[model samples]
Target: MLVRPSLTPQGAALALAQWWELAGLEIPDLSKVRGGNPETGLTASTIVQSQEPNLTPARLVQGSHHPQVALVQAHRLAAACTSMDALYKALDAFEGCRLKANARTTVFADGRQGASIMVIGDVPGREDDEAGKPFLGPAGGLLDKMLGSIGLYRATNCYMTNLVPWRPPGDRSPTAEEIALCRPFVVRHIELAAPKAILMVGGLTGQTLLNSTDGIMKLRSQTLDYRLGLDAQGASTYAQCVFAPTYLLNRPIEKAAAWQDLKRFAQKISAMGIAI
Candidate 1:
């Protein structure tokens, strides 16, 4: 067995020289550590070395550095956005979020932007990806009926979007890193839309935006206060988190229970004087 030693620069040089000698090739000068200059044969150590350090190795290996710049750039872009139009435009221009690179187009939002009820889903699905809209898949079909049961519809009564604007590769649940990267855009969406009530769809969307670890079962069928806006802007606004349609779909037997919850939600909105 060829035992290896802990190699320092000097030891590495020695190893190289020994290997070259064994190979019967002219041993290169180790004093000049750098390779020959591009213009001249005279060699010297290089000032610039390797490529930039990959903070995210998975993204780097995938041949994209988009996700790396997402968090900071998203925050800056969202902060500069004062309206939904501006926010959408900024999101379109954002090259970060690896999902965006793989996705066919930007699935920003769908339905009525000014609607009092805002529905937020986990992320875009395959159908949504094809249409460049959030929801509209099998889950979306169920969502439409769910809303219709309470006399709400996307075309006229409600607005819809996702926790993420881009669909995850292979429709997988988004990673913590991916969610963190897209958070700023979600926050901005809420601020600009200013919906009277927010319906967070599924476990991931509910947990991430609400900053809770509680499962959907524990969190569902109850009204929870969600704080919006930054501390710098006087104070944060409050909204409600409702059960997602996906949860209802998973537990088909619980549709009746969801209906009851929806009724209560509708009543609350009615009390606020917003027509369903």
Candidate 2:
């Protein structure tokens, strides 16, 4: 296996800046990393590129077709990937999302792949961009605590992923066009994981997946019908949307209300006899 050195706090920040330049994302905070934390900035030295012959960076850069269409094609080819291995395989060949062209490695989902409780977020941030994994920065740390309060942990009982596989430029909210471009892959991910319960964490994820224009406050604290299949042949998957950790971190005062929502989630799962 090819191993890469881990980056220090300062080094990660510099690398993130470089990635932003290359990927055409804005520099949200030139001095800080995503999640708005200053301590130990985002790291990128640890990222490892895929060695697959067909998925090289050159191939991604040289492709003439729109990146979004390439991604859609990749998902279609993947067709019903039911596990992380299959999902990774599909993503490796994907050349959509310009972020992939500039990133050192693809930041895919990390955690228990077969867990009963699945959490879906918006996309990878700067720290996640460097680490090549979702939810590893300050917001992720907060998410850990929130999950712990509900007796669920990513390593043991929850599978985590995002709506878009690649980080957006400059940590911006993905555009409607961008979300629509990547929608199919996320749908495939849901089908593969087949989680008993899903927690859509934030307005972006909730709105994109649930097809709602309502804000997070209006969307939170309720169970919504979530579908996870094609129109002609898909299953009626059910899930609930809640305030994303990033939102809670920004507005700490709202945490109490967020906790109430989480408690309800815990109660629902407990009643179903699903392992927490």
Candidate 3:
């Protein structure tokens, strides 16, 4: 919600100058602020010279710091990767995750830019590690069928990626430690893509994405909202998480339930008025 305050032209300009200075921005022309403060009948420039408030480091960072400094740095780095190419480069160069050591490739992301639908998988398996793309093996083939049922495909209509970009060793699920280490990259990915909707391909990805411990069977029934907190561009994302296609593949019988989930996701996409 936006609150629009009414102010006089000079008052607005004064406010603008103050805001610019507060934001550490330079304002070359300050004729408006030099005029005078509406509150005190004193010139703003004179006030700055004489009565400028001392800004201490403690005052600057007064509150709202996250508990973990490492995660904060991760968020900062993720915000820096404004473009997909930048994200790929950073993720490839990242040596933070232990999974990166043995992994043959860094599976960053695949599919079209500006894609409305984004699909997220857990981590790369053997073939995916070799190929350096998310969801391109047997699991990916199964995923294609699942999406095709709902009239979606990566080549034309979907954006596919994974939570843990580097393949986990022995085809095992990534540990919580590993997932936490790489989470910022994925969050930035979602913000950059700004996808209208998202699909989680397996339980590991589903749980990690939502920051939950629940299994897919229980989570699948609920309407899950994945909130990617504000990005550097001042844009935040609230995305819907759909059921995992790999689960559908494992238990073909559950595909019926998954189908219902897909239908719901399709309805949501249609309501958004997205083309695909």
Candidate 4:
């Protein structure tokens, strides 16, 4: 397993500046960053200026004192990627998210790229990380069956990707910070794919993308619009939430609810003149 050392506070300040320069953005006051206490004002910037600088963007990404710095870096890197290949390369090279340290491989998206329906899951599991793809193992088989039932096939009409590319250690749930760090890339992915409708599988994915506090049961019953980005170039799409295959595998009784959600999603797709 590869290990990366965490940056000291002074190292973090210097590294952040380098990252900003690399991203071609004017370096802002570090103290004013999201995680920093605004009460301190520009004190963080003052301290950064006083520190001896010696870090490159590549090495700087090993770790950071402020998580928000990493999040900003992720956004910058993801935005710089203009194509899917560029995005994948950027994500593979990105070292901001600590999850990458212990991950076997970077699990990227799979299935059709320009498919009308895009499936977004929470995070990669151990099987996904090992295979370097999303949706694998027995759960993946179930997903295939579920999609088949609705006439949505991953290889043909469906595109698939996970919110987080790297799997958490021991298959643990990803933390909020980890999700935030990877969010930009995922959003950019959706924009590039330009799918008319998105199927958000799993509660975490549904909650995060929809910005809802409701569980999968409540979330699945409603169809909502997901904004692609904050910029003018962004657009909106119809989003449907559904229970994850893995979740259904454990709770077989919930399969009925999952079926209902899939039926509703399919109906909406047809209503939009999208052929499944």
Candidate 5:
């Protein structure tokens, strides 16, 4: 049997510092990053998000590094898109995200554009990347059924897309920098679609959208405001988190809880007088 060695604390810290430098981020105070408790065992990659004003990834994409500069370009392009088609074109043309190079294709939103509800998923999975669409394979089938339960069919009343359009290599979670670069496009998508409600699937989706460190268990089944900007208008939408279909597949026992969340989601939509 091949035995793997674990990284020593010093090695781990060095690696994390290097990553921060490469990403054009300053290494935050390690003690504070660990919440002043080394036993907390939080790696830089796994740090809980803070409630800082700059928590929004879209807000971080400018004048920092090459990646951030690309993010600025993304914002300029995204702001120019007045329609979904234009946004799609922009995504296809954009080359800021490194994931784009290795991905089979750029996965875009699926379903009707003007749908009253939009479902935002985490990064695309392996199957989705191959198909160049969000929510493909078993997970997608499960999502379709889940949506159908609430009379929100993608074919008719719901629009669906992933937060990051391109799939990461090995279907790994997207890095913060990658998400930051892609966020401008996502913001424009939400604006143009103008969904009354947004169903955020997966922990990463909820965390990124709400700018909270809370996990799915804490964030689910509640109607929270997903603010678009901090300006005078304070444009926002009713958003809720639910278990990803992929998660449910791995933990079927949690289906009961997922169902309850779905029911609450449906109730919230109805209370808001959304026909779907």
Candidate 6:
């Protein structure tokens, strides 16, 4: 058998250097990102989120109520859309939310349409943005495992999306104002999908959807109703908040509580007569 030739040491080194250059792979740009330490080896090193204030290209028109006005417009835009694809286009066309300007791409839903459960998370991370799908990378892997523990998979019973369809600069938690600005699209998404259940993956999801400023612990293990209209008799959806998978990755001990929450969530699905 003929042996495959490999590059020489010098040749390999030069090739790798050229490859990196072509890929533009360099130390993360600190100016447009925040909150990670490169010295610690990337865990320590996360790709700089693209929306860091005053770092990335300028976005966000600064006015006290301009954001609110923009959100109202977003709601109008969302309301006008009659389908998921339409809504996505509307969101893509939306110019108000500052996060959209710097984010790599819109990280939208991935999974079955009209699935029994819709899982919502905070903003997309670097991986999710790159893939243009929500729930990817380490946090996504953990989410897949957690869902499996309860006999669920995104491709099967669950649908995934984010509170903010874009990533915040520097992998930082999204500001409250940003969540509010992006809220309407998700509201429209839930309305169109009309899933029987929802899982809010972090405190941001909990706080924004529940309209409470409390932390996740204060909201965890609780089942709440999502208001679909002004009247109490209007269409509603059931939702629960759990510890975020990303957070759980950092603190593995939290897995037990998250597991308990999922089991209970499964029970709710069963109670609703939907087979898991």
The model with the greatest lDDT is: 4
- In order of lDDT, best first, we have 4, 5, 6, 2, 1, 3
Best by TM-score: 4
lDDT of each: 0.66, 0.66, 0.65, 0.76, 0.74, 0.70
Candidate 6, residue 97: the lDDT equals: 76
Clashing pairs in 3: none
lDDT of 3 by residue, 1-276 (tens): 111112322343365456556778665445535575566665533433232243222221222122122233344456677799978876776554577888999998888888878888887878888998888777788778878988898789889899889887787777655776577788778878887677776777767667567887766666655554542335433244555555566778877777787788777778878778
In model 6, pairs of residues that clash are 34-170, 42-45, 49-170, 51-169
For every candidate in turn, the CA RMSD to the true structure comes to 14.7, 14.6, 13.2, 8.9, 11.6, 18.4
TM-score on alpha carbons, each prediction: 0.71, 0.72, 0.70, 0.80, 0.76, 0.75
What candidate 5 gets wrong by more than 4 Å, as runs, is: 1-65
lDDT of 4: 0.76
Ten-residue segment with the worst summed lDDT in candidate 2?
43-52
lDDT of 5 by residue, 4-48 (tens): 112322333344445667777755554633323567664432332
In candidate 4, list every pair of residues with a backbone clash: none
lDDT of 6: 0.70
On lDDT, the stronger of 1 and 6 is 6
- What residue runs in model 4 are displaced by over 4 Å at the alpha carbon? 1-30, 34-65, 232-234
Worst 10 residues of 3 by lDDT: 60-69
